[model samples]
Target: MTNTPQPVPASQPIPDSTAAMKSAVKWGVMGLIALAVVGALLAGLFAGKEGVYGALIGAAVGGGFILFTALGVLLTAKLPALTAGAVLLGTWLLKMILAMVVLFVLSDMDFYNKTALVLVIIMSLVVVLGAETYGVLGTKTPYVDPTPSSNVDDDE
Candidate 1:
């Protein structure tokens, strides 16, 4: 029997960056939650009830930051390149200001262990950031045709 060639189907378009951002957010949030739980447990061991409260507050702050940043990324991904950059910058500035305000407000509360709060917040941020970096870097996005045929005779 003569050799027969199979038809190649057209590749579907790659999902936009917003889809990637959404995935990253999901991963980041999961990482943050896991880290927060660990941090709370450590705090409870080290400082008891006050430590637990502080740890929860810290996790909440960090989670808020992650959500805000992710929302900004998702919203800006669809804009023109230059516009997206500007919007992202603005979003970052806003995030920083809001975070500062939150910390300032939390500092005045006399109940929880401030030291534990600060420590957990910092740790949670680092963990979430690391997780997001890994998720983004590890994702296998196709920059070019992912499947290439190697039939020389078929090309003629």
Candidate 2:
């Protein structure tokens, strides 16, 4: 119950905070791939080759769109907060524009099953985001207290 802070011995290594985030991203990507395969198989079973094509395209565009943000954050973890935020914000805007353009471009194309494409994209987006959220919330990461302790006996 005491607020007194205990010093960490140099012999004891600190836990890596980014490890949790990394694991989350890894699991998220794996989940997306798994979903893609399952979605493709089911779509193909119902809609034939067109379904498979639609599923693959949907997975690439939808899943990749969302996953790219997590990747940007991971890559910018070492950068200043403002810089990272700016980069992420910029990428997000660009991503949105590209996604819209892609969907619009494919709207009239009948090469793939539109239903299959739309369904897979929706499923992938939900499932991958859920997996990442679960991974992040389920794991624990340690952080340091930035404020200095009031202990007068502590060595400078």
| Clash count, predicted structure 2 | 0
Candidate with the greatest TM-score versus the true structure: 2
How far does residue 133 in candidate 1 sit from its true spot (Å)? 1.4
TM-score of each prediction:
0.76, 0.84
Per-residue error for 72 in candidate 2, Å, reads 1.3
Give all candidates' CA lDDT scores: 0.79, 0.85
Question: What's the CA RMSD for each of the models?
Answer: 5.7, 3.5
TM-score of 2: 0.84
Error of 1 at 31 (Å): 0.5
Task: Put down candidate 1 lDDT per residue, 89-144, tens digits, no spaces.
Answer: 89889889988998898778877888889898888788888877776776656554
lDDT, candidate 1, equals 0.79
Cα deviation at 74, candidate 2, in Å, is 0.9
